[model samples]
Target: MKVLIVEDDQFHSTFVQEALVEALPEVTEIVHAANGAIGEDEARRGEIDAIVMDLQMDQRNGIEAARSIWAERPQSRILFWSNYADDAYLRGIAHIVPEDSAYGYVLKTASRARLKLALRAVLVEGQIMVDREIHRLQRRGTSLRTRLDDSEFNVLIDLALGLQDKLIAERRGMSLRTVQNRLISLYEKLGVISEFDDEVTLNKRVRALNRALVTRTINIETLETAHRDLETWLAGR
Candidate 1:
């Protein structure tokens, strides 16, 4: 089997290669791409059977590259190896991946045995394997822990980025009234409106964003993804 490794870090890429070689005897050709754009280019060549990709890269992020690749070849199998278990990354993956495609999400800190198992599960056995820690985080953040629905989370990010409701509505393709309602819900979910005193200088939107940051709900990685997505959206317009 031919496998492609899409990783920017030299040491991590080499480590993954060595692990693949050790675990899968049938993997004959293990090619490498420095970043997601190169990975997509290599994938378009049609020689690769499976891909092990890093989520964040300088040229292009794994999600965008994977979306482009899967648009052309929906059956392609991808293993996302990353250092983060951020909801933004997970949500982005869910949004783009084909319904029936085989994929895996493994943390970079996972053991070699775990990595090998994940690689085989996706490439050899055609199964999905998500890291337990990631699964736990997803569950915790989604179920009664944050109580911020996808729409609310999105509005929170927009608020954090200092976007007005009108601009957010335009960007998100939501009606202005809907954006206002979402902002109200977000303020309640983040407890910004109820928890803060009237004397607080910042408005509810700003307070909600600050609360999200303090609670570690929305983070730097999330903001980066938002920025990248905005750029992509602008380029497409």
Candidate 2:
């Protein structure tokens, strides 16, 4: 397998090279680049099977580089390397990521075993394998333990994201009453009282949801059910 290592720091570049050498003996060639600009230039020039790329580079960041690469060669796997999880970036990438490849985000602080798992995940399964902390934080805030109904969660997320119920109703093809009931159930789960008027209470819930999205504090077990349901619902669109 051919690997391209893209990083700004020469030390990190060398370290990653050593790791790749340790991980795979049969790697035909391991090319190194100083930044995403060079990485992009090299990638567009030849046949690189995979990429190990850093996030914050002097040139274009890894995400933009990955986008450029994937746009040109969607079959090539790109592993995102970073020190910590940036929620905005994760959410952004997750929004646009094409399915069916081991496109992953792995923290540089992760164990070598985890690093190996990420690369192997790309080489082996097409499923994405994000690092444990990302998953942990995401699962932490997801509220999976609350047993929220899929439709209920969908309504809640839409509400929290400030989507109009009328639009949601139109989109979901549900009656206004059905939308209201879903909101009621969500509000009940969130401990919101029905008597309040004005946007204060709704604002608080929306803030909470934003925090949940940032911290991954929603319980994933239940969140996954709704997430999958909504993803399916949105798929046809």
Q: Count the backbone clashes (under 3 Å) in each candidate.
A: 0, 12
Error of 2 at 113 (Å): 2.0
Error of 2 at 66 (Å): 0.5
Q: Worst ten-residue run, lDDT, model 1?
A: 137-146
Candidate 1: give the clashing pairs.
none
Across 1-237, the per-residue lDDT of candidate 1 in tens digits comes to 999999999999999999999888989899999998899999999588899999888868888788889888888899998887776677777777898999989999899999999999998888977889887866776567447778877777777777888888988889999999988877777777789577766767767878787766776656766777777777886
Question: Model 1, 188: alpha-carbon shift in Å?
Answer: 3.5
TM-score of every candidate relative to the true structure: 0.83, 0.59
lDDT tens per residue, model 2, 1-237:
889999998887787787777776657898988888899998999799888888777647677677678778878787887875655446545644566545889888888777877776764355577788876764564455433565765566566545688867866678999998887666555545543566644554564465445443243322433344456667876
Single out the weakest 10-residue window by summed lDDT for candidate 2.
216-225
Q: Please name the candidate that would achieve the greatest lDDT relative to the true structure.
A: 1
